[model samples]
Target: MISQVVIDKVLSKAQETASHSWEYGTVFEALLEYRDPHYSIFHDPFPGGKIPELTVEGVEALRYVKPFIQTNSARLCEGNGSSSDPTSLCIPALLLYNSTTSQAPDNPYLSAVNRQLHDLLSTTPRYSNGAISHRDAYPSLWADFVYMVPPALAYHGVFTSDIGMVKESVRQCQLYCEVLSTSKGYWRHIVNAEGTGSVKSDDGAWCTSNAWAAAGMARVLATLRKSQYGSETADEQKMLLNMTKGILDGAIEADTDASGLLRNYLDNETWFPEVAGTALMAATAFRMALLEPGTFGERYVGWATCKLESVSRYIDEETGVAAPVVNSLKEGQRTPLNGINPEGQAFVVLLYAAWRDRRTVAEDASVPMAGTDASRT
Candidate 1:
């Protein structure tokens, strides 16, 4: 398990940074940070069994993210123009808060929650095939959208017992996979199928983009498994599992750097080694190991462990910022070696939370198997 001190420093630094320090700023940063608490509390390894309490770090994470949730909930309730970007990533956090806290019948957040759901389902631009557009003007797909959009839908769906929302989440992933990924084990960064304008596409397999896609799918699978539809949707769950594994396989294989970290562009050797993507990729692998022990158990655990150790070396001892990351705002360029990357810090927190969860589950499995008399010794 990672030290609590290290996790604290990383999350604290990320929360203190400028709102625009990350590509999507407070919304993305808060969403990622909120997962540490949400996953610890909700993702039960044993569905019908007891779950553990939140770790100290998880409690602190909730505290850090609550303010953002409150503010965003209020802002959205004020009737902000319909969202067109990944701002919906923050909706899950608001949903979490609203459901857990006591509220009046006329609670403004109720409107906020309903408003976001309306915008996402009825207003967001989409390709003809039903993939949500990351931009408002054109029908384009971004690997990052997988993380921002689907998990919120799944979480909301499960929260409200609306199986249709959950199904839509799965459908979005299928559409994205059809356009952005290849069975050959890589997902392109972006695709613009129509509306020629200033819209751009990146054919490269950007490492962080793949990490976003994998981690997003992992969250969706976990949510589905814990939902009322878990049994009925086994086939869809399997598809999500396979899709996540394929992305991880390609990312691990693309680690051509002597440092054992993936490059900014997985296939482009000229690009610098990137710790943000490395951390998120490793985080996703740990998630896969936890979700499907039979398939990714030893295979992903070994690779993810080694990559995590490599990632740790890149985090600053004093400030907790992970360096040598690609500038999220300018995905084509590298951040200065000395500069701090907000998303990089958040990914480290995610990596450690996932490692801790898997480690706890592994320890639990050390007991006797179901039919064993080993307990009689």
Candidate 2:
């Protein structure tokens, strides 16, 4: 397990480095769900504990994240462009609405949430097959969009009891997987499906992109399983679980160096071993293990432990920055060995949070429940 001191340092550095972009949004979600369990959307023991009265960390999370949501909710309501990244803010907006005391129909935050949702579903550019485009200029698909858009849509579906939104999330994931997933089980980084976009298609299976897809699938699955819609979405959940496992197992198999750290590009050993993707991948594995201990418990959790240990070696004790990552903003450029970013820091916390949850559950399961035999053997 990661020490509390390291988690604190990473959070501090992440806050310092994060901008009002997707990176910051990633950090915000990590802090909200994992670090501050009070605000987590998933059920207890899956990611966070029960929602309780605001704690100090919870208050800090609100203080830090509320401004971003408030400021962008209004701006994004304009539906000006095709960038899907800002859709991430919708989750935080819905989370805020859920926690608010006055949930009246006229609530400004609620209106903001509706507007953001409208912009995503109605204004966003999508392909003929219904896959949402990642960029504004053309019909492009990015592995990162799996994390940025679908999970938020699913969560909104849960809050509003909109089964259609949930189904749309499932459809989006299926379309993205069809476009990105290779026979090898790894997903390619980006594709300009229409070929008209200026964005280049990245053929390499970038490690972080795969991590994003897997983690997002896990989040969507969790939302479905824990929400009132779980029974109806059972088949969809199974599909997501299988897809997530395929990506994870493929990435793990490609770690030929036995470094527990994957290359920046999973198949290209020429690139540097990276920490950000490794952490997120490990985090997702722990989550998968929690969800399906009978199928994934032993294999996924064991690998996740090894990967987290490897990731810890890269963290600077003084600065808490995980290093030697691909430049997130320049992923299509094939750049490697960049300085640490906020998402990298956030991934570390996510990995640790998953590990901690796994450990706690294992310990709880080991002890005898009330009126149960303590030592039958």
Candidate 3:
């Protein structure tokens, strides 16, 4: 019973919020309307620097709605590679054109993008068991980047006809689960990289940053299903599925009000429900439900739908703006109804797109699978 009409309406609203990221022709640039006043950094210019996180979400939004826009392999690769990270949003968008890239492997654009992805996996620093070192500025393994970058590398294994990358993606997930999860299995904010410190405890499980892991896992599962590598047969895939279930189960248990919205920190007594984290969790549930309906997907879909209802209260009807999205754990204060961040806007797009895609499949079992639509644009 998913309505295309409602999907269209929701997509329009989210795109309005996310459109600014592309408007200035750079991943780092944010539109005037969506800017947060608390941070002076968003306005700073990056001539060719990376905003791998924002790029990942932006690239995903493009894939969801703009499937038809990528006719040229080189052009599509260039557009998506906003300073590539393995979990760079560019991976999904660019990989969508794998068929096209194969047609022109010698194209300099394809070569460069492909080289960038390859170089990341080959050279990126890692700790024991393959978790990426998140401290570009210092030494630490950010739980957020665990989901942000590695999944793309794993999916890259699929895009380039490699199964090893898929295994690598799962290993990273296992390391992330080991490092970031609570004893009860909920996500925590950050963990010291293997070399950074001996402290094994996560700094704290801030809701939104860990939500990045949920969203990343959801996408990794979706991408794995598309590969010829028999993703289901892999040991890594099974571990990932189990970990995902654990994370969601913990989230449900911690829903203090049973009201769909999750608290900001799992261990603390804060009563506030975080907007971006809620949306990410909902998206994760809906996506997992789509991935495996009998194995807790249905329950997740319900959780996602309920959580989305609570989150929608924060989004403005007229402007399509979502307020009170805490920008980052370090910089963002949970000021309810304050300014919006571009990532928050992107998550709105992601929530609608993920829910719609999964629900459409649920309601119409015969509809073509997600990546197979010949005329999807």
Candidate 4:
């Protein structure tokens, strides 16, 4: 676990710096930062997306995104204006999670997320076999979509007592494992949703997208522990067990750096280290360490701590700014460490929250598994 000192001084400072520094910020960025949203301020002017998008099934994935119209220009809930895009689903789910649970009256956010989840039951463009559509633009199944929407639903399900929602979240994670993963091995970036693509893209194993997949799996484990999902069936137990083992074991093999940080693309030749993905790996592995057993679980906790330390280079002592996070990765091209990538903001904060919560949970083992160790605040 990370120290309380680091959480207060380092992580807090870094997150504060990021809110000021990041550019091209969107609601997706805010969703990750969606902790303790002051409604009066959220109602006031803020920079976030307001456009609704459609899924391939023509379902308005952002159909429920509402404006905090008490003040103009503070469009709190917006997503890509495409048909039923999975990537856009995270924003609405988060908005609902933020608004409905508080002393604040249940806003449209919950109803919106609930609608999208229902539409997802039959729509969302699954391959004939069953992996959810990554994006409408891609004909292939993307591993990145694992984190695009599922974790949001996982939390929503647990909070709302909606067992079906929880099951769907886990089912999506399993589908990814079945269609995109290699047993006893690491995952590939893109699979043939239509079964047409080659085994490897020039992009190779993208670090953050892979991190998203692992995080999504870890999220299901976390959710089940927190909610009344009931004792896992033999199959459920095996699935979670395999997902936790596979993700951690594979990442350990690929993290070939002195800093104990991961490269941008795990199997690519250049081997550039990036912050967002490594932080995500730390979050997922550390979270899993608590639930899993024996040496396997213990190793994850240690590995996560080391990786968090590795990224300390990106955080400056004077300003606490985390920088040099890669903007994005492409099939044959590599993006430079541009501005503070929003992904860096999202995962780094999440990593801090996860580590901080573990210490609290450890002290009170009596706290139910359904309780989240990681809070946005």
> Model 1 segments beyond 4 Å from truth?
18-59, 69-101, 334-338, 366-377
Worst 10 residues of 3 by lDDT: 37-46
Of candidates 4 and 3, the better by lDDT: 4
TM-score of predicted structure 3: 0.70
Q: What's each prediction's TM-score?
A: 0.84, 0.89, 0.70, 0.69
lDDT of 1 by residue, 1-377 (tens): 44668777877777776353123333244334345444431354223332222332334443554444333433332222224333443443443344334244654554565665676567767888888876655677888777767777876776666888888888898899999996658799989876667767898999888998998898789878877778977888988988888899888778779988899999788888888899999988887776776677666788899989998888777777777887776888654446777777778878887787666656664743211232211
In the order shown, the candidates' Cα RMSDs to the true structure are 5.1, 4.2, 10.4, 9.4
- Give candidate 1's TM-score: 0.84
lDDT of each: 0.69, 0.75, 0.53, 0.54
- Candidate 2's C-alpha lDDT? 0.75
lDDT of each residue in 1-377, candidate 2, tens digit only = 46779888987888888774567668876786566653455444123322233423345565667666653354332223445677777766655565545355765666776776676667667876789888776778889889888888887776667899988898899999999999889899988866574657888999999999999888898878777777999889888988998899899899876556888899787777888999999989988777766557566767788898898888888878777777887764456545667888889988888887766756785743211233221
Report the C-alpha displacement of residue 361, candidate 3, in angstroms.
2.4
lDDT of 4 by residue, 179-295 (tens): 767653557777654444454432256777777788767656655654455464346646766875786688878888765568777776476677777888787776665555343
Against the true structure, candidate 2 reaches a TM-score of: 0.89
lDDT score at residue 73, model 3, on the 0-100 scale: 42
Candidate 3 per-residue lDDT, tens place, 1-377, comes to 22334434434544444442122121211111123211111121111221122332333333342332233342232323222222254343443333332335443434544655554455456556566665432234555665556556665565555677767777777787877777766777766654455555356667776667776675566556545555354666677678888777877777775444676665565545667677777767766765666575445666678787777776666566665566543433545535555566556555765665565565564753333232121
